[model samples]
Target: MSMSYIDKNYIYAVSRIRYAELRLLDGSVFDRLIEAKDVAECITILAEKGFGGEYRDPEGMLGYEKSRLWELIAELVPDMSVFDVFRLQNDYSNLKAAIKESALDLDIPGIYSQEAVADPMLIKQAVRERRYKELPLEMADIAELCHELFLRTGDGQLCDIMIDRAAMEAILRAAEASKEPVLIEYSRLTVGASDIKIAVRAMLTGKDDEFLRRALAPCPLLDTELLIRAALSGMDELCAYLMNTDFKDAVTELRKSLAAFEKYCDDLIIERLGTQKWNSFGLGPIAAYILARETEIRSVRILLTAKQNGFSAESIRERMRRTYV
Candidate 1:
């Protein structure tokens, strides 16, 4: 497609998103939130910022804000499937929840996420009935495999690993098929970072090479085989291997703790996507807005949780993600 055509197509959505981006919370807002004396104070800050309005509890507030975010996206974007790469993870999560709930014969409420490309209820029904035809081909196949694996082996971890790897693969495939640079870059970074986290955790827990191989998805930035080998060796070897990759900067955070490493990954994504703010037209800005809002909500959640748990302001600050504004 021509650049002009793509730009024209996304003009309205981008324009709307530009206005929406103005409401996004900045670093100072997050700082105030972190410094809040209590959860009530944190909620007051969020309310002033027009987030989680009238929802006193954190869970309800966050959930309402998330639904509002997607609702806005659905209103602005004509073709929702273009952003399926972002929502497919939620679909897979619901699939995982449904499969486990059905297998264990338990009624787990609020376990499914609302931001899915597919209907969570449909996924739950399909898994319950063993009706794979109801789901998308990619999800259907994995759902069947994971359902049977969970049933036969009773190993939730294995099932989770399978579904998680499949979710990453699906994301990569969607990014490629969309032919959008922003989506492609996001997918590459997301998968690469996930693989790194998996390697780090596996090495710490002494998981074998086979588990690492199975867990890590293929991304352009990182060599999966080398990562597997490095993970099998040790954290130092893995860190050394990572030093030669795009994630070298994250090595220091990785050495700190998993939470710090995750914060580093989120910050990297925000830094990369921040460039989209200058683009006058195209899906990039809209996508960036969506991610920015999500990041803001997550930072708020961290603050509220920390305040509720009586965590120190410095500790909460260390865990806060970078803002996109």
Candidate 2:
């Protein structure tokens, strides 16, 4: 779990990942899904690809794929903690949902993700009982803070932002501590992109400086203070700032819409993951495979949603996230 992922120990794991990567859904498979007459047909096509394997609903099949992906990685690695960077967001999401449920005195198990390191039930109980110690260290204080903040201010939006920032912060710390270059870059992209999203949303929603400051998480890839200044001014200022950074390409998507910008961000992450496929050793390929599967699962979910909702294939084809395959 230390920063020693680039050695012989990972060779076999990388080999397994290499084979696993081959099974990742390519464009042709996605095409089949899109062309399928209905959601059931899509699952049938998925089965042909070894994904729609179990006879479950679309959501259940996707859940099975995600669980199967994680199980494969855990089987290959000696320590799973190094992979915490990938799971942190889900943990925080569960925390956020738990806090909301606590405030409302409600229980909604469906809101919790199964992919997180933290158990959803534990988080629900911790928040409901006001027992912060029951949560992870990175989440404990923030959980308590958001739990009480919602009760005090009745501002669910504020609580959401705080929890999100906390999630970004925790993820960055985990990535940097791992000392994996790909992991580090992945973390930076996540944090920086998230910051831009917050900034853009602030500009679009008339959020004040206090909200922007509270929402943005620090990323070494960009100047945080400058981002705040630009966001406070307007979209032009924000786009101008983004144009000068490594994320200059994001400027066009930023101009389009938040959804387009988000899709661009996801595709960029996949572009980063692309390099891992050529790697024959170390954790990069395994890590990349994890993300690749995530992208694949997410895209499949999107496609299924489009099918269920009668969304046009053209609309989805334009925004479907790039796959690692």
Candidate 3:
């Protein structure tokens, strides 16, 4: 931790982010995106709003946007220490993408090929060369970890569970290491939401005990064994089990649709993160701000897709994540 926590550099960075956020429309942009009939029209509208990237090609736009934002974040926090919280997630995403390629018997490829890892051949060669040693410190064991996960989980829902569990564990551990109250709270809320989602899916599908166990993501708030047991028991049992948790409000809705429940959880996380960004100290505020921006971008994309697909306004609204700002 740097002793100069409230220096001019930090203040300047925060002010720039605040100004950038203010330039974004609250709900008006979302409304426009939801009404866009085609990709071109959506891109034109985005350009009009100062999101002037390569709109003729969506992939190029994604790359450009990701690069621009990441560059800004780097400039804001030159040491990259503040973004370490995301290292675990980046490692996990890279591994998952590799596993997906392996499962299909294709060469290891990056899912976000444009922004990072543009060449599939290069990724394959790196894995063949045991090049984990050449990667970032946090990513050193990621290749091996992904391989192990695939061997163990075999591309089933459990694969998702394993990766999410690892991510949650990392967040909790990092929170502990930093002794940041906001991080701890955020980790607990995220894990609790995840548990709720898992429980709902298990109860709805009548999955096996083994499956439930394999699908569970490890979190600080939930006793994994007890949660699996409750999920296997019944929906009523699962709901009862979550009596004291943060996601109790979601239980009733979860009974209807797991997808909806999951979306609700995501919106809640984004909202909470946005709120934290306003009051956070040290690097936490910057990290939270980045998450909020990423989340907003996702929301806009979702809206655009929905509109282009001809979904109704009510349907689009239903799918929109709650705005934290």
Candidate 4:
């Protein structure tokens, strides 16, 4: 095997990330996070751990914490220019908040704060003013699309589906553009896994075909109709449907518990990305390293929450994703 395809920069980037991952595994950080009573205390503790960033508000610290964590990692890796991806994910989340506010017709400040964008007011103004391109990422464009869907159907569910669909489309596009096998594989795996989750949830919820179509995200790997049909049938049928796909290895674990299955899938994806021997110069290795860190942070949060909530380690393990460990 000629390692000619490997980029030297990616290798260096991964090396740096491996060091950062070690820092995240520190027990003291988790102890501090677990000791925090409220969101403010958590933020303060995290700030002490070098999590510096301007959060939106006290109540929304959960989202702010995740957003800021990603931002810090982005700052660490200038080669990874996917701040827009994180911003857009936040925007999608914020758009959900915005629509909820619009539905309640309530006065909600810090709407933009929910979004990771620097000037959410500007993004909101852009959408309110109908500048879809100015939104943020391809996902932001989906949020804009959701606004139109909201106006047309008056169904919040449809708007949510539209945004999800747009995201799937964007990820598929990104996967296509990714020069490395790791990102392309990760993106495809993400789309497929997401479709499985949607199918399983739909089957459990007893939603109708129309709702399923409107609710399910459209991705390149799985056909929407197949998901709807499997969902309408049963879990066995759904599992059988996915068994032939690349994710068949997950079906056995998922059959035990949906939460476990989800965790398993996440670990698989993270492991797949983290193990790839990409060189450090390009966006590929950095993106993988960043996502890996985010996974570890979320895992720690889950552990802390579980400990605080009195959930057993077994129960917590069901929902825990694989980390650098």
Per-model CA lDDT versus the true structure: 0.89, 0.88, 0.65, 0.64
Could you tell me how far off, in angstroms, the CA of residue 190 lies in candidate 2 after the best superposition? 0.8
Better of 1 and 2 by TM-score: 1
TM-score of 4: 0.75
For model 3, how does the per-residue alpha-carbon lDDT over 236-274 read when each residue is reduced to its tens digit? 887787775667777776777776887777776666666
Q: Which runs of model 2 end up more than 4 angstroms from their true locations?
A: 1-8
**Candidate 4 C-alpha lDDT tens digits along 139-257:** 45566667777766777876766666566556656556645566667777776777787777767778788877776666666777877888898988888887877788888987887
What C-alpha lDDT does candidate 1 achieve relative to the native structure? 0.89
Could you tell me how far off, in angstroms, the CA of residue 257 lies in candidate 1 after the best superposition?
A: 1.2
Candidate 2: residue pairs that collide: 46-52
Q: Candidate 1: lDDT of 72? A: 94
Error of 2 at 135 (Å): 1.7
- Each prediction's TM-score versus the true structure: 0.96, 0.95, 0.80, 0.75
lDDT (Cα, tens digit) per residue for candidate 1, span 98-191:
9999999998899998789888999999999999998988988889999999999999998998899999999999989988788888889999
Which sections of candidate 1 miss by over 4 Å?
1-7
Candidate 2 lDDT (Cα, 0 to 1): 0.88
Q: Is candidate 2 or candidate 4 better by lDDT?
A: 2
Q: In candidate 2, what are the lDDT values of residues 186-207, reduced to their tens digit?
A: 9999899999999988888898
Worst 10 residues of 1 by lDDT: 1-10
Q: Report the lDDT of model 4 for residue 54.
A: 57
Report the Cα lDDT for residue 166, model 2: 95
The candidate with the higher lDDT, 1 or 2, is: 1
